[model samples]
Target: MVKYADDFKAMVVQEYLRGTIGYKVLAEKHGIKSKNQIVDWVNAYKKFGIEGLFRKRRHEVYSVQFKLDVLSFMKRTGASHAETALHFGLTNPSMIGDWKKKFLEGGAEALDYPKGRPVMSDKAKNVKKNQKPTQQDEMTCEQKLEQENELLRLEVEYLKKLRAFQMDPEGYLEKHKQRYHSNSKKNSD
Candidate 1:
């Protein structure tokens, strides 16, 4: 069924190239289920070029390759359920979960499709790798307080210096005052 869809998708794209008016008429003429299906093919062709219409089936799931492929498709493809269904020759996209289960239960070899259709990951893999830390990650109260205390200490040091400077130019410059006078007098000389 998936293989059939790939052929059909190629057919649709070919007919579309023959021209839009004739394409719609031929679709209506041929009793194609949904005119939108052809339209989707055309759009996909425009976006991905000819090869986008090809179907892919996994021979095995959970292979580093399979995980990488699935994850990549999920992350980068952003395709709709209809596309996924049409893609795997699946009647429904939910079967992807079946594939996942098979993958988990058996590994890559579990990725068997009905008939002899090969599993599709293209060149990419769909592995679920570790994710980068997010703000949601837990932090200990001690760690949190340590950070705050460090920040507060720095702030206090800054404020203390600011206050001393604000209080009197004399103390702030006591050492510099003599030096300042001497430098000015030396300059005049």
Candidate 2:
């Protein structure tokens, strides 16, 4: 959790790489929490220089092939998560662990970058670009009916819930606890 400066990290890594002192001894000398952290820094420095020692501005997106290659190399060499991450120039070793888990659970497809936003289809994009406001009636019969049905279902659910709350305000509140209730209240209860 401690954030070490880039210069400090480089210095530590250089010291470790010099072969003058062991990780445990260096960690003890520098008052570091774990010797493994020093090992990670040293490996990162060796593979990626000082850049890997600093925190990245944004998350790195890896291709499926790249992920597969990293996993393959790790397996072939019997390397640990930290070692593999260091070799790959990844700042966090946990990322390699996550990739391995995803690969094991769902194969290469699991390594694909998750789409963060919904993209408009080509037709929709053209419509928007042309500044043509399409009417709801222009939708296919099936699509119009589906949208109406969904709206009706939502309204009915809302009314039923509202009626229940009106009929039994105390009981409704008692049944549904506030998710963000104060910790002091929880402790007292």
How high is the CA lDDT of each candidate model?
0.52, 0.69
Residue ranges of candidate 2 with Cα displaced over 4 Å: 1-8, 14-21, 115-189
**What C-alpha RMSD separates each model from the true structure?**
25.5, 18.9
Worst 10 residues of 2 by lDDT: 179-188
Q: What is the C-alpha local distance difference test score of candidate 2? A: 0.69
Cα deviation of 110, candidate 1, in Å: 11
Task: Give one digit per residue, the lDDT tens place, for model 2 in 28-115.
Answer: 9999999988988877777667887887766456655456656655665578988766655567777788888986786555667563
What's the true lDDT of residue 25 in model 1? 76
Candidate 2 has which clashing residue pairs, if any?
A: none
- lDDT of candidate 2 at residue 96, scale 0 to 100: 80
How close is every model to the real structure, measured as TM-score?
0.32, 0.51
Report backbone clashes per prediction: 18, 0
